[model samples]
Target: MKTRTITGVFFIIVMLASLLTGHYSFGAFYLLLGLFCQFEFYGLIKKSGYQPNYVAGLINGALIYIAFAYTANTHIVQPVLFLIPVTLSAVFIQELFKKSTTPFQNIAFTILGLMFTVMPFTFFHAMAYVNGDFNFHLPLGFFVMLWSNDTGAYLTGRAFGRTKLFERHSPKKTVEGFFGGLLIAALAGYILSIYYTEIEWKQWISMAILISCFGTLGDLVESMFKRSINVKDSGGILPGHGGLLDRFDGLLIAAPIVYSYLYFMAT
Candidate 1:
């Protein structure tokens, strides 16, 4: 408990400070986070009886950074959409040199892993780099909503949980907790919408629901990965939080949704 409280407080403080600063320094923070996630992902895939090249992982990791950088620095939509295919092909080609094991599964897993684990992070970059004073706070709004939902569900479920949400996948999750989280998240959305200037009330509420549902799904997805890999946690990079992927699993799902919302709004 003490570890979690201290870790959580410090995590929030650092993340908020970096994000709210609205500068290239936040990019540095995200770059480190994304790289850690990539490392964790490579470790997870290795459990399936395959070894991913660090160079390959590094290349793929850099692609994620570049994709996010495009949103921040340039206008390269076509390459962004084409990244997964390109990266998958590269992985496939790499398999040919290794006469030991079939690379098809590795390629497929790498592609899927990037899509599931890495792509949504680009949204954070997009949010950070979005032009206009009002738009600057959008990412922070998503962060607050995600955190609120997480905290609310945990506390409420502990207090009044009866029915399990997904016992096989996530034993601790509860339907009661899900709804409790939504309720609090909705309230947080309302308040944040009032304060954050750029987004609409409906948009905020809708985003809150999206984050709650998909964030839970993200947690379930990570849980599935850990279960399949026969691991308890993703990694122990964070003090009380398991790893970058473990902590950002919810954000992984929510970030893309938030990004899409903004993208469509832009178009």
Candidate 2:
């Protein structure tokens, strides 16, 4: 309990500070996060009887993140998208020399790593520039809703959880907890609207619901992968919180949805 509490507090502090500091801090933080997730993901895949071109995958992931970050920062859509295929092509070329039996699977996982890990992080970075300027409100509000949903679910699950939400993938989550999370996340959205009035309460509430539903699914998806790989946690970087992927699984699924919501709102 003590370890979890301490890690959670420090994690929150670093996250908030990064978001609040400026674009540089935010970009660096998520860039490193995406790289770590790719590393851990390839590690797991390798453990499951496959070689996933870890070096090539990491390089590709890093380039994808940099392309998005650069565009978000400079407000210019450069031809950096070309760099992705260029980097990914290296994986296929390198695979031919490795003599691995599952070369095609190796290439597939390498590309999938970018989609699974780096793309969502790119969406997350875009939240900071929702209005063509870097204001802390949109991203900050997004995270506030996420945290509220997580807290509400945990508390409600412990208090009144009976029926399983997804018994096969995640046995501990309950239907009651899902609704409880939505309710509290909606409240948090309303609170965010009070201060960060750029987006209205209705939209914020809608986003909260989306976050809750998809975030829980994201957690279950990660569990499914870990179960398939015969592992407990993704990694032990967080002491009690598992790996970066374990902690940000919710963000992985929720960020793209929230990004789409914000983009449509802007359009």
Candidate 2, superposed: residue stretches over 4 Å from native: none
Global CA lDDT computed for model 1: 0.77
Candidate 1, residues 17-106, lDDT tens digits: the string is: 887675666776777777778778888888778767656656776676776576565554646746755774677787788874657777
State which candidate has the highest lDDT: 2
Q: Residue 100 deviation, candidate 2, in Å?
A: 0.7
lDDT (tens digit, per residue) of candidate 2 on 14-129? 99998999989998998988888988888889888988888888888888888888887778986987877777789989988998889899898888888888889989998888
Instruction: State in Å the error of residue 230, model 1.
Output: 1.6
Clashes of each: 0, 0
Off by over 4 Å in 1: 72-88, 129-135, 265-267
Global CA lDDT of candidate 2, please? Answer: 0.87
Q: What lDDT does each candidate get? A: 0.77, 0.87
